[model samples]
Target chain A: EAGVAQSPRYKIIEKRQSVAFWCNPISGHATLYWYQQILGQGPKLLIQFQNNGVVDDSQLPKDRFSAERLKGVDSTLKIQPAKLEDSAVYLCASSLVGGSEQYFGPGTRLTVT
Target chain B: QQPVQSPQAVILREGEDAVINCSSSKALYSVHWYRQKHGEAPVFLMILLKGGEQKGHEKISASFNEKKQQSSLYLTASQLSYSGTYFCGTEGAGSYQLTFGKGTKLSVIP
Candidate 1:
């Protein structure tokens, strides 16, 4: 079976610029998630989608970050006015269901200068 | 809240044994383990629920202690492929959100 897929394995943007990352989860997966991993740290949950609806996004910075999974199969995460602190890897994962094992994508490494 | 992992890093020769521990301050519903190589996505290891059941994958096994809100990963007779950063993700009671630990770096050499 194919695993989660993501685009632009690497990205570079200037501070205050906008950037977007894409994710296509495993087929038939019901739950999707977005996470941010800073250097030397574990991935932090940014948002979660259960099908086409969002289940959790409490940790996400609404002022700058946003994500959506319109069809429940693919999702996108966007960051506007990116800050230097936003330089990190953006990972996308999917699970058969909530609270189940998650399979992660290769991730998009964003470098904000 | 984020979980705490111990022995931030460890080095071992092949055929050795090592243990990585993870503890959470809040009540836990489940604990998930994953290993990630440099610049790679994390690979799922195993999940231990609140029942305190122990799960194993190959030479790697894990145990979850509900009473103590802690989990430990045991790697016995380690191989070179075992070298990576291990993370423990925890979910609180009645919640599905997983908060992860800083990670434990394990290096196995021949």
Candidate 2:
């Protein structure tokens, strides 16, 4: 079976610029998630979607970051006015159901200069 | 809240054994383990629920103690491929979100 898929394996943007990442989760998966992984740290949950509906996004910085999963299959995460601190890998994952084993994508390495 | 992992890093020769521990302050519903190589996404290792069950995958295994809110990952007769950062993610009761620990860096030298 195919695993989760993400676009632009790497990205670089200037500070204050906007950037967007895309993800297509495994077919038939019911839960999708977005995470930010910094160097030497574990992936931090940014948001979660359960069939196109948000399940949790408490850790997300609403002032600069936003994400949406349309049709419960494809999802996008956007960051506006990116900060240098936002330079990290953006990972997309999907699971058969909530609280189940997750499959992650290649991830987009975003570097804000 | 984020869980705490012990032994921030460990180096072992192939065929040796190693254990990584994770502890959470809040009541846990489940614990998930993953291994991530440099520049690669994390790969799911196993998941243990609130029943205090133990699960194994190949030479790697894990045990969850719901009462203590702690989990331990065991690698027996470790292989070179076991070199990676191990992360433990915890899920609280009635919550689907997973808060991951800082990770334990394990290096297996041949």
Candidate 3:
């Protein structure tokens, strides 16, 4: 079985520039999540979607960060004005409805210089 | 809030044993353990809920003290494959967000 999939495995952009990351969840999975993992730190939840609807995004930075799961299968996370601290790995994960064990993708390593 | 992980890092030879501890300030409902290698996403190891008590898989197991809001992961007869950074993700009563710790790096050498 295929695990979660993400595109643009690595990205490099200047600070203040905009960048976007894409994710394709595992087939039949109902929940998708985006997480930011800085160097030497664990991944932090950025957003979560349940069947095309947002279940949680309290930790997301509304001013610069946005994410959407339109068809409930594929999702995208965007950063309008990136920052130096935004240089980190962006991970996408999916799980069965209310399932605690999540399958993660390769992740997009964003480097904002 | 993020839980506190002790020792920050550990080093052991093959066939050795090590214990990693995680503690939270607030009451926890569940604790999830994951391991990540350099440049890779974290791999889920196990989850320990306050109610489930002690659980483990193979040589790796975890114990949770519900009253103390503490969890300890046990690694016995460590192997080179077990070398990685360990993180404890904690969940509260009714939140979806998982606040993860800084992580504890473990290196197993032969």
Best by DockQ: 2
Docking class of 3: medium
Cα lDDT of model 3 by residue, A1-113, tens digit: 98888999999999999999999998999989999998888889999898999989998999999999987889999999999999999999988864387788999999999
The candidates' DockQ values read: 0.94, 0.95, 0.71
Q: What pairs collide in candidate 1?
A: none
* Model 3 chain A: worst 10 consecutive residues (lDDT sum): A94-103
Q: Judged by lDDT relative to the true structure, which candidate is superior, 1 or 2?
A: 2
Top candidate on lDDT is 2
Q: Write the per-residue lDDT of candidate 1 for residues B1-110, one digit (tens) a residue.
A: 89999999999999999999999999999999999999899999999999999999689999999999999999999999999999999999878889999999999998
Estimate the TM-score for candidate 3.
0.97
Query: What TM-score should be assigned to candidate 2?
Result: 0.99
Q: Cα deviation in Å at residue B24, candidate 2?
A: 0.4
Please give, for residues A1-113, the per-residue lDDT of candidate 2 as tens digits. Answer: 99899999999999999999999999999999999999999999999999999999999999999999998999999999899999999999999999999999999999999
> Chain A only: TM-score of every candidate?
0.99, 0.99, 0.97
